[model samples]
Target chain A: MREFALIDRLSQRLANRRADTRLGIGDDGALVAPSAGQELAITTDTLIAGRHFPVDTSAFDIGYKALAVNLSDLAAMGADPAWVTIALAAPELNAGWCDALLDGALAAIGDASVDIVGGDTTRGELSLTITAIGCLPAGAALRRSGARVGDLIAVTGTLGDAAYGLQCWPTRDNATRDQQFFIDRLARPQWRPGAALRGLVNAAIDISDGLAADLEHVLSASEVGARLDIDTLPTSESMMRSCDRETRLGLQWSGGDDYELCVTLNEAQLDRARAAIDCPLTVIGEIEAEIGLRAFDRHGVRWNSDKARGWDHFA
Target chain B: MREFALIDRLSQRLANRRADTRLGIGDDGALVAPSAGQELAITTDTLIAGRHFPVDTSAFDIGYKALAVNLSDLAAMGADPAWVTIALAAPELNAGWCDALLDGALAAIGDASVDIVGGDTTRGELSLTITAIGCLPAGAALRRSGARVGDLIAVTGTLGDAAYGLQCWPTRDNATRDQQFFIDRLARPQWRPGAALRGLVNAAIDISDGLAADLEHVLSASEVGARLDIDTLPTSESMMRSCDRETRLGLQWSGGDDYELCVTLNEAQLDRARAAIDCPLTVIGEIEAEIGLRAFDRHGVRWNSDKARGWDHFA
Candidate 1:
């Protein structure tokens, strides 16, 4: 397949003809109109072949994850995704591969409306980049520097399933229901619909680099500290059945790729926020006057912070 | 250098905060507010190590061109560039290389008034991707689809200089003034300042893949054809002095990477439009009812359109 053919296929699948998208696909650049008082939120991610994911992974999963990861950033900012630009590099183009990739990418944006506006396709080492553009009300973006003392630290959805899935993928068993659930979570992460809680949340960050590391980013940015209640971590039935309590806790704290939002707020209105987005959120900790992370078990004894080594791409 | 440290270096150079940019660099995504009555224009480009530029080319030039190429797209759409997101991948990060790269990129945006918003860094084969976002007045974007049958075909600045420079690069023979001029054009292309002609122009496109191929895109999109007076082609002093008439014409017709604007309009207000942008504009052809390119030399004899083979990535 030729590059233009691949681009043509991608453009056709990504076309949505939105009114605000003044020009899309075949133009030198995409033209979009933002309504007055709405601010544009732009995020970019580059997924490499071997470093970010296993080379044997399906194009479908790669495509889905590529856009999913980028959208996760917008979600952290409480922005509604509207458009995406992809820069794709590959050794060669295969028709079936391209089709599967688009199928997964199109399905990834199932409800949260977004149009693939403009992009670049070229020949190179296998790498896919996505820049997701979204919008929010001016001065209403959820930032990492907003957490204050006494705010409740919460997370949207269950954590650590993706990391568990990655560990189990080597075996490729899937004999138990737990394996499938874990793998699915890794391959296709569901983004939290917490954009509605923009004003309610004091600070937010998407969990890509383990819960501990990502939360640290918020704390450092806000110049605050966190006290995580280890026993309060939200876990799925599959997660609980698949591992011991200490192992589950380790994964919850250190396993990355959750793509869930770690949010902080002053009030304990998680029920309302969860209902607003139809997603489960658990209050796992609280912002403190301290300067660093302090994790405690049910007995209120602190867990060693040195044990949590979060995912770092370069490292 | 670590990814975060490299990002810090980049941020320090690219930090020229603007009012509309609510958040930049260190955030999950950049937050920007486009003024009312303006539409956002966005484009993305990826430059592979061996394909787009020589593997041995200076990192500074690579970084500058990476953003310059994307900005050219905005220039074609007649948009005012504002924000950029960059994704960089390299086998290894060298401190000197990073400094030079950012220096060149920051210098490239001189007086263009843009901010490096947010991006990613990863370890992989050498490649760079840039997504530039700009804005234009609503309903006033110059598009390739707006050309009329009688519109005059014009180009900005001189052509064939970059192609000449590229061909002359291997020898490293900058002993002559002409060779140095050509090589400089290849390394640092000046994007035409025709965005000011938005209201006055019917259609516009940036010449990256040579005039013949790029102009064909505009013609096909506009559902029109072009008739070119080959003798009227703009030529730099060095280009004319260095090459014979036939070789110079070939470079003019098929040489890519000029980064100049090829704009079309009907009324003969060339001087006014040229004065608006302070860029030299030369009329070379006319849009016609004909179905394809028709070129004429000084003798009025038609030059075979088949000879105008333009650059194709996949070809």
Candidate 2:
């Protein structure tokens, strides 16, 4: 089949001979042996061509972001991303384009220590569904329901840059260097949480649906609220240069596609947790006994959380 | 929010406290623990509305068949299925219809020892992608490339029943016993190979793309050929009552959606393999030194393997 042929092209460049992967790709399924005393983590996401990404977007960027988002889920759960399966359904396209797409995906996967183990390809609507599997020690996976009162809430890296990217994408020009950074951020987000920091976070979630909305998931699950310090929120220099204060701040608060990890942890673990990631880690909030998320400015005034637009109306 | 509400409704009824599944549906990802010294088997499939099933097919049938096809892949590999992840993308549909789909999928999943681990739900074109993870002892996972010359080729249960169902679906009636039986087979294909049959077959594959084409995959993978006895194919009473012998024979040979296991094994293993499967297991062919699949009539004359319609012309 042409689909299998394309997969073979991707497989030729793969060097995934991990000790745990007794079998990877090319069979009815892939065979893996999880480490003793460790738990396995799995996540799946579907990206539609018109709804999730621009139709004209390069296959390489699409491929990179698809895996990146799934990796973000693993990072949020404090798991080491190990394997992925992609089920791509598309209208008829040039084989060359498919090859480029797979090359881009494999390029991203190669560095993350993730293997393309299994997949299904068919002709239909253009959609990509990916399942990422990861591993962590038993009882050590960072969940969203473990945040307690007074826990320091922190985020790994700047936010809203990707949202800013999406906002300015149509007007992006080669001359707007700062805006280009936002677009690039949207296209290729890095997962800042590494294996070394798995057990340090009390609660965690990936910012796929904006910090305000995703944090609400943590609050609702943990039965606690958070007070975020708006001034202390991390913002990229590019985002500041590209937009006005209100637009920038609004994007920072309610914008989606950040792919950063928002976590709650003990204050004592802050130094060690920050050291584990190369990105700037900012302490944005603290959990409270109250049951709804709120944000406060440096002047000690509450900012309206309801004003920030929620990305996923579905959730 | 409605999607999460629907998921919660499904989750409340789930009693999955598997020691392997530390975390389930609600988290960013699920946490599972595979036993030490066992290999994990992973398979993924994607089914699109209109392409995989008739647009008017019931949500219940669609949901059941989606999981059934993936389970068939696991059965082919002789893997003990353990976990499943579904990424569902659909256009706007009624809440009641969505509930019916989930109920159907859950009903099928409830009987198997598999847990619904993680998934993504979103608004998009209608498609369902499922990834199933299974476990087997290290080096024990079945493969399609292990068949050798002189091995006996066998099949489980009946063939062409689902294909027959599709052919007769337009005329199906609730009161027509044979038609209802065929339709049910199409919707709820049972994976006949249980755990007891694992490691008993040399090489296997689910008969998805018709025996003429799927057999080529095994032959090409194993670097062997097959000579199938056309008379030996297992056909159901429903098929006999519904069609002429020639039509039944043609459907049995070239039709898809059987979900039956077609395998090759040493002649000595026949008794044990048949004993392991409660469904009828019949020797249908033999692996040979020649490099092509040839099906023979009971009179010992070769039937036309090439004239059989290729279900997947992509190959």
Candidate 3:
């Protein structure tokens, strides 16, 4: 299929939704009206080859992961996904690969209730940038600066699975069966935070960078410090079985690409939050008066180092 | 300066604009509330190095041209310029170059009363994509499908200056002082027909891929045919002096990137349109009953062609 034909076919598949989208695809740009009493939240993320993802990754995974990560941003803001515009750059027109990629992207968007409203296709080295727009009730959206001292720091789902999966990808023979599950989670992580927590979480952020680095972002934004307890960090059963305790804990603490939500709430609201979420909420820390992050091991020893850094685009 | 700092500087400079921008810069996305009874019109254009522009072109001109092309799209739809989003991909970050580029971009946006609301920056091969959003009254949007047979085919401003500029860029020795002026027009074409023709044009499109090709797009969309007079095509005085009559006319008829509005209007609206525009109006043709485009000379000699070919991405 040519670029125009491929876009037409994809547009047809997307038009069947008939949801909140005022205009579907086939135009210079798409038009959308926001739901009443809601503010639109928009974000753009670009995934580049050999930088954001490995070069050998499947086209399907690339497509799936591109939209998934942007959806994760919306989830962190406690917003309902609405529409997305993808600007794709690739070297040549590969019909089969394009179809597969679009399939993966549409499948992910379908699950999130987001429509592929508009996009641009061009020829260049492989790079995909997705701009997602979500809607949230007026004055009810979450922000990174809403956390207060003495708030309970909680994280949904598991961390480090994606990062560990990446580490094991280059040497499959060195990976155990349990590690394979970690790899899958890394490649196709789900980012649904459930609709119930819309009004509950105060400050929230998704763990695209490692837990330590992402937590630092919240700390810096909220102007509060945090002390994470190593014992309370959530690690998947597969992670625990495949790796030693220290390695698992270290990965849980510092590995990145985990699209899990790390949210902060007042101690008074913890009971309500605990009852709201279906996923495990690990209370690994507490916000402090000081403005930095620290980690305490099970032995009560603080792990003070400059080594537990996450992914840096410039670096 | 770093990317964030550069953005901060640029945002500060744009803070003085009085455009209908609800939110300006330094946010996840800029917010603009369309006026009551108005619909948002949008279009995106991507320019890649060695593809859309010469490699050694000045950064400032590149920036001016990038935003100008998108503004031309808004002009074609008979919309008032409102907001623009720029996505820039480059191999390296140079602060001086970035400042110069932003200067040129802001100059154009400022001129059109469009706000530089939000944008994305990434490191890659040099390419710039701009998504411009405008506003037209609920039922007054001029679309390509609204043209009717017997309507007069008109063009705003002259054509072929930009294409002529490209040819002269490689051979400075062949370019006269007057030719350089035409070259600059090609390098940084202005978008006309701002708020003046919001309700006058029956159907319109910007002449990016030359008049023959872009008019065909309008024809194909409206399912109509046109008979263009080759003798009536508009050209700059410099263009006429520098090139032969055939080449100058051919460039006016078929050259791309003029960024001028090509519109169809009834003969009844002709006098009002001529009075409304700041630039002169040239009637080049009339819509035909058949379903294809043809060109005729002043002597009524028909040029044989099955299709009006423009710039094709894949071709």
State every prediction's TM-score relative to the real structure: 0.96, 0.96, 0.89
Fraction of the real A/B interface contacts present in each candidate?
Answer: 0.78, 0.81, 0.11
Model 3 Cα lDDT, one tens digit per residue, A96-118: 88877888787667555677777
* Clashing pairs counted in every model: 0, 2, 3
Candidate 3: tens digits of C-alpha lDDT, residues B1-315: 456556666777677364344455544344444444565565667788877888887899889899888888777777777777777778877778888888888766655667777776777788887777676666676778778999999998888888888888876557678767876887788888645776777888888887887887789879999988888888788877788977787677778888888889999999999899999889999998899888988777776553345665655
Q: Residue A198's C-alpha lDDT in candidate 1?
A: 83
Residue B121 CA displacement from its true place in model 1, Å: 0.5
The two-chain DockQ for each candidate, comma-separated, is 0.76, 0.69, 0.34
Which window of 10 residues has the lowest lDDT sum in candidate 3 chain A?
A15-24
Q: In model 3, which regions exceed 4 Å deviation?
A: A1-3, A16-20, A171-177, A193-196, A271-278, A301-305, B1-38, B171-175, B193-195, B275-277, B299-301, B304-307
Displacement of the residue A140 alpha carbon in candidate 2, Å: 1.5
Which pairs clash inside model 1? Answer: none
Ranked by lDDT, top first: 1, 2, 3
Ranking by DockQ: 1, 2, 3
lDDT tens readout by residue for model 1, A139-177:
999999999999999898898899898887776654467
Candidate 2 — what's its lDDT? Answer: 0.82
Off by over 4 Å in 2: A172-175, A299-301, A313-315, B173-175, B299-301, B313-315
Q: Worst 10-residue stretch by lDDT in candidate 1 chain B?
A: B305-314
Scored by lDDT, model 1 comes in at 0.85
Better of 2 and 3 by TM-score: 2
Interface RMSD of 1: 1.1
